[model samples]
Target: MEHAELDALLTPEAMTLLDGLDPVQTTNDVARVVTRLRAAGHGPELVSAVVGQSRLRHRAAAKFGEFAGRMLFTRAGLEQATRMSVSAHHAGRFARAGLRRVADLGCGIGGDSLALAALGLDVLAVDADEVTAALAAYNLRPFGDAVEVRHGIAETTALDGVDAVWLDPARRTTGHSETRRVRADDYSPSLDWAFELASRIPAGIKLGPAHDRDALPEGSEAQWISVDGSTVELVVWTGTLARDGVGRAALVIRGGSAHELTAPADTPDEPVRELGAFLHEPEGSIIRARLIGDVARSLGAGPVAEQIAYLTGDADARSPFATTFRVRETLPADPKPLARALRERGIGTLEIKKRGVDIDPAEFRKKLKLSGTEKATLFVTRIGARRTAILADRLE
Candidate 1:
């Protein structure tokens, strides 16, 4: 949003209009609201700002829940903000360590700062963008004197009184909306400066889940977190916030429950073995943390093929770290033979999963020419040196 539009949106009249309007969710909703507001004699700027904000609030609900109704957001800021559930976990680290004051550097829309303040910890939330800083102040207004929102550069901000720091350096180009990803070398405040700050004080640095592991600093705990089935972010913990002797961690959150697997360092991969009755696909967080070995040991499983993430075992086991599938049968790997085999089994709806294979699932699905009532999953993968197809059923 432009500064003028933001100024228009912040007025008492605009805020009340936004609050009174029903939730705007679709293009139809936007069009209807725009027409009604324009007909009511509201100026174009106020109408556009309110309509745009309403649309953003609908999208932000996935990350902020019900709190999104009152909060404001820019497109890029909302996209980069951490989910409320994940932010609470980040806040828990500081609260558990007995840290009372935290400086949340690059506090986009105050997602993490809100979580920290909600736990009764004082917060100094700083964002380099003026509009983002204003939105942060508004979102964190409920915390009253406990939270202070500042418009300033994170590297130059004074941290004299804070007990710890939470750094989420800008990984995208500068903008209030429509920003593109920037290279790691171009990160705002610079990783070098951020890492140096972490070394002297308890800190948590949030980065993309796929960040290069080799580039991470030594003697710190790297934790990859996945919400539902999607791996979200990697957090590097230093000083007191870093758990003793733990170098890698995977945290998986599915629905209301959460599970964590931790090891002193990257666990070695298990030796490859023949396919067992059940196949296990490790969660993204586990794969990213390189802690699949620990989960495999717990489930009495081994890799299906060398360097493959899929695990196989005969044991009846269920784990939060991996999804288990019961093997039904092995089929011919060739597309023509596989289609014939699937047709003979009366399989109609097929869930195609592939690894170490070049075929696109959608195109391959069309080639099957399927026509039946039964449903099954087809795993197109390599077994040792040969390509193979495995028919399986997901074990809930």
Candidate 2:
């Protein structure tokens, strides 16, 4: 958002108009709403700001829930903001460790700060971007003195009076739209500076799930978190914020329930064995944390191939760490023959899952002429040295 648009958005008139309008859920409604507001004599800035905010509020509902209706956001800020569920978990870590005051550096749209303040922790939320900082202040206004939003560079932000710190560095390009991921060294606070600060203070640094594990600092606990099967972020904790003796962890959250598996460090890969009756695919967070071996040991399973993440075991122990599939048949490796076998089995609706292969599921699905009432998941992966396809039923 431009500085002028933001100024107009903060006015009492804009806030009232935004509050008065219903949530904008469709792109088709935007033009009508924009025209109506303009016809009502609202200036372009007010109309654009109100309409834009209405759209963002609806989009943010997935992350902030009902609280999104009362919050303000910048496109980039909302996109980079941590999910409320995850942020609540992050806040709980600090609270559990006896932390009372926290400096949330690079606090985009005050998402983490909101969770921290709600947990009764005094929060100082800092963002370098002017518009983002303003939006954060407006969003966090309900917390009163419990939260403070500041406009400053995270690398130089003051840590006075704060017992702990949370850093979510800006890892993308600058613009609100058309932003792309930059290297870890290009992070706003720079990983080097962030690591230096972490070593000196109790701190938690949030990074992408795919962040270079080799870049991790020694003695830090790296936790990978996934929400609803999607691996979201990796958090590195240092000093008192770090859980004792825990070097690696995977936290899987699905349908509001959270399950965690922790290890002292990266464990060796489970021994490769023949594919068992049941094939288990580890959750993305577990794969990212490199703790699949721990999960395999727990389930009495082993990898299907050397270094392959797919686990195989006949055990019926349902685990939250992985999705289990009951193997029905192993189809031919070639796509044409596999498609034929699937058609013969009366499989119409199919979920194509692949690893260790270079085929697009959407494109491959189009090639199959399926017509039947049965539905099954197709796994295109490698077993030993040969590529294979497994038709399996998803197990709960």
Candidate 3:
């Protein structure tokens, strides 16, 4: 957003209009509101800002829940903001370690700062972008003196008197709306500096879940978190916040419940064995944390193939760490024969899952030419030295 639009949107008139309007969800709603606001003599800047924010509020609901209604956001900031549920867990680490003051450097839209302050910890939220910093201040206004928002570079932010720090360095180019990812070497508050700071203070540094594990600092706990079914972020904990003897952790959150699997280090891969009665697909976070062996042991299972993530077992075990599927039979690996086999069984509504194979599920699905009322899952993966297709049903 431009400074003029932001300045105009902060006024009493514009804010009241934004709050009073019905939920803006569709393009039709946006057009209707824009026309009405313009007809009512509202300036182009105010109308554009209010309507744009209305659209953003609708999108922000998935992250902030009901709190999105009263908050402000920039397009790029909203995209990078941490989900409330995950940020609360980050805050819990600090609170559990008896730390009360936190410096949330690069606090995009105050997502983490909001969680920190809600737990009664004093927070100094800093953002390098002036507009984003302003938006953070407005979003965190409800916390009163518990939170302080500042516009500054994270690398130079003063951390004096703070018990811990939360670093979310900028991983993308500078912009309020459109931006693109940059190389890790180009990250603001370079990893070298961030790691140095964490060594000196109790800190939590959030990074992409797929970040190079070999580049991670020693003596820090690396935790990979997945919400619903998507692996979201990897957090590195240092100093007192880092749990003793725990170097790897996987946290899986689905709906209202959460489960965690932790180990001193990445567990060795379970031995590969012949196919069994059931196949298990580990959650993305577990795969990212390299703790698949632990989950496999818990279920009395082993890998379906060497270096393959799929696990198979004879026991009917259920776990939050992985999804279980009952193997029905093996089908032809070739698409032509597979389609004929699927047609013979009258299978439709197929969920195609593939790994360790070079094929697009969507394009492969089209070749099936399916027409049926039944449903099943097809696993196109490698078994030993050959590609294989397994037909199965998901066990809820």
Query: Which is superior by lDDT, 2 or 3?
Result: 3
Question: Least accurate stretch of 10 residues (summed lDDT) in model 2?
Answer: 175-184
Error of 1 at 83 (Å): 0.8
Off by over 4 Å in 2: none
| Superposition TM-score, candidate 1 onto the true structure | 0.96
Descending-TM-score candidate ranking: 3, 2, 1
Tens digits of per-residue lDDT, candidate 1, 164-211, equal: 999998999988878899899999989999999999999999999999
Task: List, residue by residue over 1-396, the lDDT tens digit for candidate 2.
Answer: 889989999999999999999778787799889888999999998899999999999999999999999999888888988999899999999999999999999988899999999999999999888888899999999989999889999878878898999999899988755589998778988999999999999999999999989999999999999999899999999999898889999999998799999989988887887888898999999999999988898888999888688998888756899999998888896868877888888999999999888889899888887779999999989887789898899987
Cα deviation at 145, candidate 2, in Å, is 0.9
All candidates in order of lDDT, best leading: 3, 1, 2
Residue 74 error, candidate 1, Å:
0.8
Candidate RMSDs in order = 1.5, 1.1, 1.1
TM-score of 3: 0.98
TM-score of each: 0.96, 0.98, 0.98
List pairs with backbone clashes in candidate 1.
Answer: none
* Clash number for each model: 0, 0, 0
TM accuracy, model 2? 0.98
